[model samples]
Target: MVFIRATQSSSDIACIAVAPLSIQPFGVEPTDFDAFWTQQKQTLAQIPINPRLTLLNTLPSGAKVFLLELDNIDNRKVYAYLSVPAGTGPFPAVISLPAFGDAPVQPEPLIMTDFAERCNSINLYISAHNAPPNLPDPNAYKPDDLSKKDGFYARTMIMAGIRAIDYLSTRPDFNGSLGVSGMSQGGGWTIQLAGLDKRISAAMPINPAFCEQDGWRFERASGFPNYVLVGRNLNVDSNKTLTNMRYYDAVHFMKRYRGALMFQVGYEDDVTPAATQLAAYNKYRGNSTLLTMRERGHTYPFDEYFLGRYAFFEQHLIGFKNPFNFKAKFLADAGNDRTVKDTAVLEPQFLVNNEKNKVSNIQWAKIEGTGNVGFQTENGKTVARFSQKGKYLLRVSADFDYKLADPSVASYYTLTDFVTLDVGESSNIDVCDSDKEAPNFSNCPQNIALTTMGTSALANWTPPTVADNCGTPSVSSNFLPSQSFPIGATKVIYRATDSKQNTAECSFSVIVTKGDSSTPPSKNDLAISLTSVVTTPRPHSFTTFKVKINNKSARTFTDIKIQIPFPSGIVTGGAATSTLGEWKEWCSNNDQCFTWLIPQLLKNDEAIL
Candidate 1:
């Protein structure tokens, strides 16, 4: 198909004006994110380009709202409009990337209002030139050569985002501290800029797409025309291109991005597969967090209401208290099959009390008007009371927060630092509020017991029963009394207990031999084994000696202990070896089998005589 172009020429460039807003600093400093970006080098530029400036609207508060356009100066000029709080000697700056769809898009007036009035932060809506006079018809932009590498329109739009950052930095009143964020395509671009750009201190990407390509959709999902166009444009060399593109891929780049990030995804999403998103999430090796929506999908408010998604940006971008910071993730319920349940145990050290920085305490505690909830104690220990069960969100407040011991800290932010726990089958949830100053574990009660083994008829010892809040308890095992016996065995009994204090004892009997049964392998038949008898007495001059053995069905030979009586004491010798195949040698002077070989003989499939 031959492509047609329409051009609109006017010497005038539409400008976005900055709102006179108060910029608040999050008080956080920039972090080093070298290894993170190293993995995403192929898909990203070492330095971002494209800068433009324009005026938008005038606020009723007598503040001028301006837009700064960052063009992807390499080829296509992607534009991002930045709105700053006018008049100042450098105020904190916030750069916003637009959501997926068209470019040069403006946000809801309320969002702009929040950025200007409430957040006192600069705002930007960097969009692709997909609209009117400046852009080709959306339908005209097809996946072809020119549009792939040199003209992937969305990539150019992202270039505009970079330029917005440059433009914001040049402002006399713009502080170096910066924040970048967006949803969907904007989210993808935000993550890229946060990882590739050194100037941003924090980033928030909500309901991000393009996390995993091959992971789920195999290629691209239906209707999404952006990335396919990019791949085609880059003329991605079949073999080497994918290898190289892996570096530019968002999932790959996430590994190197150092800016603190708050990523949100939905579990029931049909659009972006959870597995693919999780693959990208796993690559983010920074001061970051992951929030999951159980019954949500790819929608607007749903993405916004996704737990910590908005709060992450509120704290990182606009400098506000994070509503989701409770410390210690006690309840991780991915209602559908998509839940991540790898929660480990929460350590006790996080319960300490500090009285200094209320900020640190807030980091540890959940302030509920009157008081806080957690293990709060001035001494060394903290004990909180739990009245009911269910999923409980715990928050800990501490005065002081301590730095990690060393670089060995794989996760700087502990799951235990903010937690959610499910209590009671009907009431089993008991959440704990912890602090970053202590040890943290995400999900506790991680079932690590061996569930299955190869042996079909093997005896599975019952898992030791566990009870809580009963102090340190002990466990002991007991075997049933046995007497001298013959073949025809019935049962063998064993018991386990934790003694008197709320002790639970379990007694079970295993049958060694079964003549015939319709049930085949019953519980008793499974735990024990009985094989044909082999009589190999210690060597004697005559070879065989008669020993009286009683066979009583009522007496039950299962627990019967037979004494190997020696008529002339035991003497290690010959013929006995021939009678016994691999059977172990008997003890000299004592007509008894070798104690060490009991395990071996028990497993040999031969019956003990």
Candidate 2:
């Protein structure tokens, strides 16, 4: 619950923490924590793993790559990219977890080619969610609701990690030196897996999220998936939510973890704040080392620090000598210029002093802005100009090629510089006047210019900031009419968000007169009834359904579409008939479903399918 901020003499060096590590546990350890997990594992053990492996031959690497899939709890499947070094004997194994977003997991051969070849081990990069890796939308597998105790998202994700280990144990080349590594949510999973599975030998979690759930209560930033605390404007039962969260808290797991742990923490990380990480680190009872970076935030430095992690695994898992001697310094050309105009040019420089290391690649040199600011090389040095006015952080990372004994590993390091661009002040906007008896919805004004003084002035408004049943109002520089609103006074909220993520919001009321307009109809005014009556009682028998759609509203409905989902076992022979509508049947993942579309339904009209 205590924080100490340590100032650094150089911007390259992060501000370190002066506070002593304290074991300030947040949530109470559930009384049935052990029993609950035991039951979970036993339940998972009962399911048959209809495992499947497909070799990927296009990506040529030192190791053989295969796409592996196995069934987990909840009928969800685990998809991972497995890489095994070409060898018959057993090898050390490592499981890499993913971060906390919808970011795609690159193909195994493309991402882990270097690490697998260097470690000469089996690497399994599993999807954080139930869906396949590199999915266009990773949130597709996200649970519908997290408040439910029995089927929480984190529980399934944690079990996937455990089940991944179970799958690894069954492999013929399993050497048993299992280690888990990941950043953010992945880091939290590493802790959860290492604690739950005794077979795990080591774990390295970087800026792990989902720890210290009570930090926000003490006025500190909470970790990712900040579930315990309700939203800024939300109503929920906090006591019940907190009770369910304690079951999966990483700090509680850290207390029971018995594996070798190398935890990396960023002193300036707002996502997984240092205070929260320390809370878990201080309580760890196993052999552990805390690697602290002063200048880093939510991201890993990826330089010598990351190399140290690889070395940790190499030493413990494969008996390789630790290549711990590596150093690099990041320099900025702006010097002490903390604030600059958006037109100013900034160039970053890298200083590598270690003789044993070589900069193999310059990954990127870019600024963190709302939009892309094009980069160009000037004077043989990488330079970027700020396009939009806002605060920006210029980040640079490079891969350092080095060797430790027989294995050659590439260590990536990153350096960042913070700067603010003055784009000028945001302009306040006034709501345009509308007639009280205007037919249909009034057109919210458009092209309301923002301050042009800065680099770029862009405007956006929060959706549903003001609730009007006339569909959500749309706003850009100008307001546009959405759906027709009922005759009433409704407030519309608008805001301008700058490149720096700064915002200015304003609200105005629009009064609609009750001249010729009736009250807006609710979306739930339509009623649907589907009754399935079996024509034959035996298996593979024909089934008939009585479907009815009734418009229980005074307003006419247009473009009415209804989708009916059926179980996988149901074999759709085809739609029998439809009255005043068109019906179509489709199959998704071999599951039959039906959709009906009605062009228009008059008030109080009914249609049967």
lDDT of 2 by residue, 1-609 (tens): 333453321234234444324236556788988998889989899987777998874334447777889889988888888888766648888888888666666674365544556566777888867667867554654653545555567888888888888888998877787878888988998888888889888888899987887655656656766766542223446666667777777888887886677777777776778778878876664344455565567886555346766666765675322334532222222223366544445544444433322344332333345533434432223444454556554433333333333233222233222344443322221111211211122333332222121122222333423222112333343343332333455455565443333344555554433221243346677888987675455886776787888888755555567788877677776545776668777534534777788765655779888
Q: Per-residue lDDT for 435-467 in model 1, tens only?
A: 212222212222111111111122323333433
- The candidate 2 region of ten consecutive residues with least summed lDDT is 430-439
Predicted structure with the largest TM-score when compared to the true one: 2
Model 2 has an lDDT value of: 0.61
* Winner by lDDT: 2
Q: How many residue pairs clash in each candidate?
A: 74, 9
TM-scores, each model vs. reference? 0.44, 0.51
In angstroms, give how far residue 212 of model 1 lies from its true place: 2.2
